[model samples]
Target chain A: MDNVDLLISRFLGGKSSAAEREDVLKWINKCPENRKSFFLTKEIWEASSICSSEIISEETKQWQTLAWRIDGLLQKEKIIRRRILVKQFFRIASIVLIALITGWSGHSLYLRIKSKTTNVGYEMVIASKGQVKEIFLADGTHVWLNSDSQLKFPTEFTSKNREITLEGEAYFEVKKNEKSPFIVTTRTHKVKVLGTKFNICEYPEDKIIETTLSEGKVKVLAGDKIVDLLPGMQSRINTETLDVRVGQADLDVHTAWIDGRYEFRDKPLEKILSIVERWYDVKVVYPAEMKQMCFSGVIKRHKPVNHLLDVISALQPIEYSISDSEIILKKIR
Target chain B: MLDENELVRRISDSDHEAFKELFLRYYRPLALYARKFVLPESAGDLVQECFFQFWLNRKSFIVHTSLKAYLFAMLRHRCYHELKKKAALQHYENDTLQRLRYEEWRYFETEESIFYFDLIEKTKKSFDKLPPKCREVFDLSRQRGLSNKDIAENLQISQKMVEKQITKALKIFRNELSDFLPLLIFCVSQLLLVVIRKVFF
Candidate 1:
């Protein structure tokens, strides 16, 4: 119980004036003993703060929520393991049967099927709901895959070309190589590029596949149409009609997810909720009337889903109830 | 209770019970520690993220120090990332630099933070020995973050009395700490040896 000890205690309690705080800091910097003693007192203060029942109850609730999420992850992993095993068995069995009928070696037939599928030596990287994954290819191309998306790429690129297939959404920074062009194939369109940065968003449920270029050049092909896109340009291909439309790109809206955020500008509530669903890994059920309700705001992807819904409800006349895995939204009268 | 090393070994073996035990013990304290830097709402998420990451990388996660030290270090790293991200969004250069300076001060002082793990248990035991009124006053000052004057007025006590109780509580904590002084000296000497080797080698 010295004057400086009291000052350090006041500082740790966040009650010291700025001058007093500076004095405490100066004392701590005076010697290692002073620093150690300050930290020791600070720890006793913090540990005593945890002895209250309020914290224990809060701790129990938080643990349950975290435990539930961990359980879900474990379940999903088990299912993925089972699915891979079954798929591998079927793949090998079919390859053997086809080889016998065609009078070819099993190894050669396996190679033929692999080449036909274009996945012979490819590795699949998946980003589950509420998660984002980054992958680096052999050619030094970087991809930021969005949630609920998968990318298939070879372990090493062939001398002639660098190719990858995308099923959901990804942002790419392709390494520049003139001799071997980088190409990305989605279900609806194929994008060819050479040393460029771009984002491709083509979720299967969406009606359009959009590619936004941030730097350099890219050529997007859909059906028989080929369009060259410069930086600050976007190409949207209609999944059903195979028509391509090029327009000025909104870089913020397209690439915000890379920074763990989503920007919506007066978009329909339905569209926003769909993105929110993927962002939180939770299903949302709402009345039909609210479908056309438009929302315009930016939502951070790392926050709890309730925080997002609370902000939305404050702006609009709506009420949302959250369950274990679903959010039910009701229109407020 | 299982030892810290034993818990880590079991965790790497994917023993859910060991993970749960560790989470139960550390989650609250870690979350409270994070609140020193982040908003209350985001602190829990940040802590949970660390646990999830630890689980995912269990096989490859190496602990050169104790598990408690390793976890606190990880959470501190995450908090720095979070602060930088917010700073990036605001794009305020001075504000970012100011926050970084403040954090760096604590970062340098944090080596002794890991030493508090066992001290915390001993402190909790000593807490129950404090007079009921003294414990209440200290809780108001520490847990509720109330000023001495504010706590005095709220509890209808004098400001001097409030300070006296808090001072008394600190005395008990220091006495408890003295019991661990020998152990602390040994640990510090070991750390100094390692640092000396690295610098001279």
Candidate 2:
């Protein structure tokens, strides 16, 4: 109610003068608690703008179109790989006779196969679509991966670093080794640690990459820039630009998947549905009008798909029905 | 990081991680750059095409320059070709589109946008947690865009009471923050609010 509080409110409402805005900014960033509160207040004020239905649909449509294109190429890559192998099989038979006629040529053919097999040295653990799986490395480090995820690791840890590559999302309880650090390599960034607990969500399909360190210290290296994350902080790396954001980690929200529980604090109805699709392995057909309807709640990952749908319907003004692997969500009239 | 040349070389050998690593590294910036020249909607499509080409040609692909430079050159041609096909070649000279001015454009183009996007989602959640009177006052000022005096008059309360209720709402949001960030960057905290306000509001 005091003048400073009035200034803060005015600044939040876009009515504050330049000097007053500076004062509010300084006060808000003076500590974490202030930043936290400013975050909440801004959210409340920005709600209506956030609910813009057109922008949400357009953005997702962009992703869907690009994703379908990628899927087309990925499937094509699969067939092409097989075709190459078949052609090579025929060539190898003819190659053997030619190689015998020329000793050096035989040695070269052997080297080519050796190189190809060596390329396959990297082992991949794929959690098929709609699957979550856990793996423990030889070093006692534990990793739990989310659905439709892939972890590519070497058969044995190299002398320099223990490195593993992640495609979708995973949580790690790394074994401490001061001499040899554990490194997680994603498509865009690398997380390095001597030993630590953290969760990483860097789906190639998603434009953003998130890293939340639960305990100890981990260094997040993106490009030439290296960011060190302490326990309880998350680094959000943008795939398109140079901006990397460091903010308070919601440990419960980020780590909830470890217990098969998914928590959405306040997510759009459509956003939740996409997650539901990944969580329940179902295709969601929802009315476009309800895209702006936002909800917040916790849903266990293993519960029946309808159980979640039922709970959501009871809480919010939306109706849903499921058949086979498809679920349709309609606005309640 | 291994120099991008090494990454691209490894990608040529069909290393999915390396390809992805390269994709994650360059995709955002390339998308942003192409967006400057091409129609906004076509930017992402063009970049994806570039990546698809990069993947298909990996076996024979060899880059003599930095991978960053390589990607930029590849996308530059794609955007040019796209415009030519549309017969909007004059768009290439678009004074507004030529220089990206990404410092301001980043809020819309970068991954950091998610932070603000999320604040909107969490805003409702946090607002719902405020005390009843405080939430009511916040809705009036924010959703209804009423002045503090107007809100006070409509609610039949003192202006000071309205101020107090709004302050109470902010306090609730602050307490709800998940403590991932240690709040050490004094500057980001300040610039963040300014930027989020400019962006979402």
Candidate 3:
């Protein structure tokens, strides 16, 4: 063994004979290097020992604190989730009451509309500017429509199939029914799902129709072609050619609006502004020949549209104008 | 002015005052020693834990020498266990011990044969620069693992004088070692960065 190792062993072994100990002391005195090594090792060991002791103890204390805090947070989360589930339960239970009331007061009106309608069980819901609506389908599917969007579905689905037509964007949580397949038909393609939750965005002016699947399985169909998707997957369909591309999905970004937040993950400047305009019921126009920008973050949806604009402007040099219902953006060169 | 034996006895009897005295006496040296092997944030925690353990298990304490050595031994054992736990968690890469061994072997065979010899020479020069009696006392106490009493008996000095000299020596050594801090920090930071990267990404 080297002199340092020998010195360390002699110091720590704790059973050195008197003669051996004397000999080690003699060696230490004879050479300054041996003494230096000994002192250095001792100093290092002392430092290491003290440090590890403190770290373990401090971590233990911090862990206790964190455990308590996390317990309370988890309890709060459970309560919130439970409350949401109860609200949904009541809402579903009250659907029968709504149906009964509509049937009782509007029987003649339904007869007039039903005689004019060639298709049975087909219903269309359209929301104009500054309008928000919620729909509870016969199959227990729930949809929340943003402003200026349109959704078409059947009042009651057939035993074998459930389908809907879409224009613009809608968030959906389909009730699980394996015997009957649920499909959403957009401008360019169809999303066939069996007990899955997803969002479909198919605005007419937009060039792309995006479908983001949050859970379960979904199949995106374009004419005879089909593409299957798993959870955390997104399928983007080109409105012009109906070509489809699949990629990983960021659920928090896609579903943030439903949770009263606007989340963007590297989205183009144009796309973000359009979403902001629709959700806040405003119009945003940018400079005609400016460079495009992309951003990734979350903003409170309830915040004024200008607040979000200010945040974006701080990231890059930009200016904006807000009128009664119109907002314009310009790049600062 | 109480002797080491009395201090240990009082500590073992759940004497908070004595424990606090022991803690204050050894806290600096132990913290400095621990900072050599662990991150600064963790070093403080380790020192605290060592003292806590010492207090918790004081009833079973056994000491044949200065309480300093016993506490040092406990801290060393805890450090080894901490390193072992870290090594276990990082199964994909070479551990610090293995890397040190490999470097030592390579040093023995390569043109860097005199590299460690040069380091030893530089270290010896640094030691020679210290106060003579302080160096002598530190050498005897550390190299031979002698108790302060034994050091006093052999060097023909009082035990209190020996402790004083040793404390002075440690302070000088800590100041002198500051130059090596950057290299030490780099190695530890690299290890931590690797572990964090693996776990998070």
Candidate 4:
């Protein structure tokens, strides 16, 4: 390489021995044009350095902040999605479990009743440990008796219509017969059906009468007033006013007793306790103020009453006692 | 030299630690050099992107040359592309302004009426008259502080050729301004003569 090329290489490498550095300075001094070129190069280099440093630092900071914000948003979305999935899974699982249990219990109950039958004319009696006797009518109709309840019906209906009488809550599935209507007579009211499924809830201690229709149609008569119910419809008769009001019926809540699943939907705490008392064959007592609380949800009717009480106590402050065939509930404080 | 070759081999094998070591070794100086060519904010990014390109094309990299030379060459090429882009943008802006003026006024003329305007315009015109390659060599040496060897390496020419080009450019500049030099010298000599005459006449 020539002298200029060697000098250029040293400068480009940014390396120079003390003697070589002096030689480059002397060369620059020998020519005015060379001096001007060197000064211009230095100025341009300095300007570029200043400009790039400021811009690079600003861009890096902005990019980091953007990345952090994106990470935070993604994390929040993941948490929300996880919570929704967990809740949805639990809700669906509970419904499925309830259906399976109810089906199994109903099948077992049907088998037990079938085994006890002797012949066509003989009475087929089914009695629980502390509950009243029940019987199934010949035309695929069912009747349930509450504790201390007694129901009597012929094993076969030979005449124009099928009829039965009940002392307490009894659910019925009346055989479809347009020509021969089915009738269920209670202490205060009579229910007439034309091939419909319904529940009649009447107790001596409870003055109000409730009848819910699950399918087809039923006519409820109290005094002179008559109420006709379609599928998924209910009627409540107030004994004091002698008035009847019809509204939407929930089969799960109204007919759960026959399936061994007692369900409540925003019912008053007093009413929930009353149903529990009859199903578990127990007595419940609570302060007047505590009766205002509402209860909702379903529990297996065969489960120990204490288990159900524990669920309630977890949600609110309450206490309970079990004595042989009775259960009592009261506010904790 | 053996260690450098080994590091390059490891880097080609996708070893991140070796690559990181290489990056740390060259980042500061390359960034400083790039700062002389681009805006301060973009200098670090330019340096990082050059390293990224190096890794991306590692499979194709010829390991015969020192990795340092190859990296510097890549940076230099990127700087040239950046300058070309900036020049195009400037040209586009100037063209837009000129078009806008013509549309509004219907007549646009190049003004030549500023102080020392003729001399500066003449100097620019003469500078533009040089051969393209000669001008490039001169500019890189003068404006970029690149030595002849760096210019030869960057431009793919012999070091002797870069030195000859710079010498030719200096001779042309001296010739172009020779007339002004004589006048300047005569004025300085007259000033010196008067000062001496006043001191010892």
Candidate 5:
């Protein structure tokens, strides 16, 4: 038994022969106590090797930081949820009001987009639910508008510069003209480029306005902060904080909507479901647990919303039930 | 004081108290474990982030294993990611060897490793009870990875005396830890009971 102790110590101290190592392994497997002692000794040995001298001080500080973050996040989550509820209520009320004023049927209001020339000599294009629209500007720029989005532009390009207003998401391939810079204005940001291919997303419900440049250079201006984004770079502007973050852009994921697919890499389920809600025109009601659960895959836009839900349910232990235009997700034991 | 399964359920239900309980229970051990793979400065951040993410994904996080095991697994994954990021940023030194060593530890990882912080504390208490000379000899052998002969020579003691001290230390560890095991098993079984009830219910 004492010999076994020596062997175990030798093994842990990195001085054990191969034969002694095997012997120690056999003894550890011999009984639960042996295994426990083996682990206990290893834990002590590893703990002793930690070079940090200020462990206790650092631990208290870290705990405080975590506690503060948790408190802040909990408050933020509650506010965001309440805001979302209020926004949804107003959205439904406005839709009903628009339907009444235009004398349009409810079905038509739910599914049809309108592009009208206003008396101010500007064109306004709105993409309805479950629809994607492509438009060609007079300056020869091509724009692909995503579902539930709005784009406003002048009927003709002015001599100084071409400027347009957008809400929600759009992918643009601008016609190059050095003299005339193309500018897209959204609620929180303005993207300026001489001529470049890029994707901009600024959904009103979202907290961020994301712009991904695929080709050429573009300048993203959030209030006074201006950042030049080169090809394959993305900029995220926080609408509330107004902080801008720039990073390497995943072009495929950003531009996948133009190709009739939603390609995501480790994106949260809540974010994906929100997009799904826009694409399928359904209201998703999921528990809070879905917030940080992530999924990665290609979801074809042509398929029914059930196809995407089925894919999610298969990968996760979640069960879903669909009503007329509402879906409920529940955790499955 | 609730069982892990109950705590997870409550956390999924957005019970902040349950989340706090879970964090306070696991934070020290997880941070210690993460320090094995990454820098000490990053270790605390990594573990904290893991807990935050765990809380956020509580509803969808279906644990096929023990919650302790799952937490360690997530921390390990995050440590790997952090190492990869650091390697990419530094670009001068090759972190492949460090990464390989990090991967090697996965084999020896037991769910029991989560008890490291408590075990080490108890071990230190028991160690303090030992005679000073015996403690010194054992510390040299374990902490510095010194050979028994080298320890004996460093302390100007006979090699046989060094061996005897180490054996004595191990025997005390065996006894001290054996007395603690039944209690550990009882707690573990209680956790298992909660998990079984959750699964079958």
Candidate 6:
């Protein structure tokens, strides 16, 4: 080994004096090979580590996976909140759907969003079960919060961002604010928009979040994955698996809920039951893991809960009984 | 040195990349340190537990020392718990042996263990980069503990050539390790590797 090499080794160990450090730097600048060796030694494990390259790589991959898993966990915890209000029902979306033809502001919602001023800085808008509420924000943006949903919004939009967090389902007709883009954050994603009309369905009880845009544009940012939605597109996010799927939005089917109607396009019976339970404020207990039994069609919000159940039973080979908040369903023999 | 304060700030905001940076910096040394107290099989788990707790609870830390010192201290305590747990599982007659083993580990300390593992790994890598003929001669002389004359006879080269090849390998190692600090750091690691292999197996 060269004399400079010894000096360099001493420098790397942090045991070198100022004179030794200067000598190492002088040697490094003397040739590129010396510099290369120096830098390589900094990152490269000792000679012994060379034999364990496979193990090191495997360990690196394991650590990376753990970090990502923790990232997903943190996001999930932020989105799923527990407390909910049990309030009297005020059904009014049937009229709001009719008012849809009268410009953006006049697109009446079934009066579901009830804004209760909480603290000084944030406003909590909650839509109780069996109700849908329309909210007109300070910035002329209109929001329709679905039943059993919660939205936390700042009392006033900051000069830079019109930000709000959603937990269930909502349709936003964001008043065009190019300078202040509207951002809707769920547990795992941030949907950014510059004055757009879109419906977001993210009920905690459901496994997937469905976003269907009717007008303008929105971009959903989930971790490193970004999905852009055009007016005619729908992006479905599987929360548990953290997968994003994009397809044509049967716009009417997804937006039907905002219009005070239940529209299912061959959706599974399990999902239909959950939606029914939330809409009418009742629990439907069916067979465990019943995803194969899919139901389709539209039911107006005003339809009697029993009538809907009867319609369901008649169409599928299923029988049901209702007792208080519970509706038990069994397949016909 | 990695900026612990900056990493803590980024980690508090739930930055995956920042956490990964810390993981990469300390993982191997931490794993090797844990191995001194626990079996090689469980060493990884112990190191992983230490890092997981450290990264997950970064926001709650009140750092009074360097990040490396903090991690070493955390790893030290982890190894103690691991040994204590292992002691709990073993028969009482072997209890003294295990306790003495823990003391031996503690006396050796963490810095020397990390320094040794790194030096051995670096030296082995440097040695491996030699030309095939040079590597054969040097490996026979140093690794197989063959005399220079024996290495020359085994490799069908002159004793002088064997010494030359070994010198060439040493020269390359010294040059490559020049930027590294403290030459003596390289000695114990190679010795310790053999000792560990013998003891563990």
Best by lDDT: 1
Better of 4 and 6 by TM-score: 6
Question: Could you tell me how far off, in angstroms, the CA of residue B24 lies in candidate 6 after the best superposition?
Answer: 99
Q: Model 6 residue A298 lDDT?
A: 82
Against the native complex, each candidate's DockQ, computed on alpha carbons, is 0.14, 0.09, 0.03, 0.03, 0.09, 0.06
Deviation in Å, model 5, residue A8 alpha carbon = 99
Q: Please give, for residues A63-163, the per-residue lDDT of candidate 6 as tens digits.
A: 87676667677766555432111111122454555565554444333222222223227789999888898998889999999989988988787558889
Cα error, candidate 4, residue B168 (Å): 99
Residues B117-201, model 6: lDDT tens digits:
5555577677778889877765665545467777778778887677677556666766676656344333333333233223322
As for candidate 5, its clashing pairs are none
Candidate 6 chain A weakest ten by summed lDDT: A82-91
Candidate 3 C-alpha lDDT tens digits along B16-105: 678667766566555554444455565556767777777667779888654666666665556556655665677525455433322322
Q: Which number leads on TM-score?
A: 1
For model 4, the local distance difference test gives 0.63
Q: Higher lDDT: candidate 2 or 4?
A: 2
Q: Name the docking class for model 4.
A: incorrect
Stretch of 10 with least lDDT, candidate 3 chain B: B107-116
Q: Tens-digit lDDT track for model 5 on A1-42?
A: 778777767776777777877687667667766666665555
Weakest ten-residue segment in model 3 chain A by summed lDDT = A43-52
Compared with the true structure, what per-residue lDDT tens digits does model 1 show for residues A61-120? 777877888789789988999999999999999998887877767668888878866743
**lDDT-best of 5 and 6:** 5
Residue-level lDDT of model 1, residues B144-176, one tens digit each, is 767899999999999888888887788777777
In angstroms, give how far residue B183 of model 5 lies from its true place: 99
lDDT of 4 by residue, A1-333 (tens): 246545633553355566776666665556665554443333222322222334345444534443454346457757988999999999999999999899999998888777645332435344433454445577877566555455656677766767677666777777788888898777777889888778888776667888999999899998898989988998988777768889997887888777677788787787777777766767776678878788888867668778778988888888777776666667776
Q: In candidate 1, residue B2 scores what lDDT?
A: 92
Worst 10 residues of 4 chain B by lDDT: B106-115
Residue A127, model 5: Cα distance from true site in angstroms:
0.6
Q: Which lDDT value does model 5 have at A310?
A: 94
Candidate models: Cα lDDT each? 0.80, 0.72, 0.66, 0.63, 0.79, 0.71
Candidate that beats the other on lDDT, 4 or 5, i.e. the better one: 5
Candidate 4: segments with Cα more than 4 A from true spot: A1-134, A144-148, A324-326, B1-201
